[model samples]
Target: MGKAKYLSAVEQGMVVGARRTGLSVSRTATLLCFSCSTFYQELPHKLTEQDRQLLKCVLHKNHLSSVTTLTTEYQTASGSNVSTKTVRRELHEMGFHGRAATHKTKITMHCPNSLLEW
Candidate 1:
């Protein structure tokens, strides 16, 4: 038995070694300078079917629409009850642009004839 040898290599070197190696997973991982368990753990997890659908809908619905309008429509159609902040955060995450306009419309739009009482 002798002292273990450790070689220093950049991240790119490890990737190239992994691609060229024809060995067991553990051996490949050791040559790449990483643990086998860690190598497998680095793989990305797939999104659920529901999440995929939601993402597709979000991407196709509007490109530059107001966040408030999108949130309202999503809530009305899906009944998910997400907050305005969540909607804004999602829009930001998606890399959408444009500022949110201030809402200045009257509270009540339908008003019939009314008599003044002075």
Candidate 2:
């Protein structure tokens, strides 16, 4: 219900460097343009146990294609509502990206020259 707790990569690196330079948590947070309390609150990622289990299920399943489909399947199986944006953002955080799938390639490529090189 609070503002989403997100720090950019630069901010995260700066936070680490601030600690290394012996900046107090309060000063460091101030330098980063946010309150010390917010810094502490946002510092540790609080992935709930339920979210972890659901995310694990999502990552391990190959049948899933898009976040739209993923959210639908998750809601059906878990009886809960999770947004496509939440799934998409979390997927990005979890090191997964979405790209349009092209049907140009078959299961096997017919490049004999490339196959011979392999």
Worst 10 residues of 2 by lDDT: 40-49
Which window of ten consecutive residues has the lowest lDDT sum in model 1?
40-49
Model 1, range 1-118, lDDT digits (tens) per residue?
A: 5444443456546654665665666887776666666554443323334643574486467756666777777677666777767666555555755667998977866655573332
Model 1 bad stretches (over 4 Å) = 1-59, 99-118
The top-ranked prediction according to lDDT is: 2
What is candidate 2's CA lDDT for residue 108?
A: 72
How well does candidate 1 score on lDDT at residue 113? 55
lDDT of 2 at 10: 82
- Poorly placed runs, candidate 2 (over 4 Å): 1-47, 100-118
- Model 1 pairs in collision: none
Alpha-carbon RMSD, each predicted model: 15.9, 12.7
lDDT of each: 0.59, 0.73
Clashes of each: 0, 0
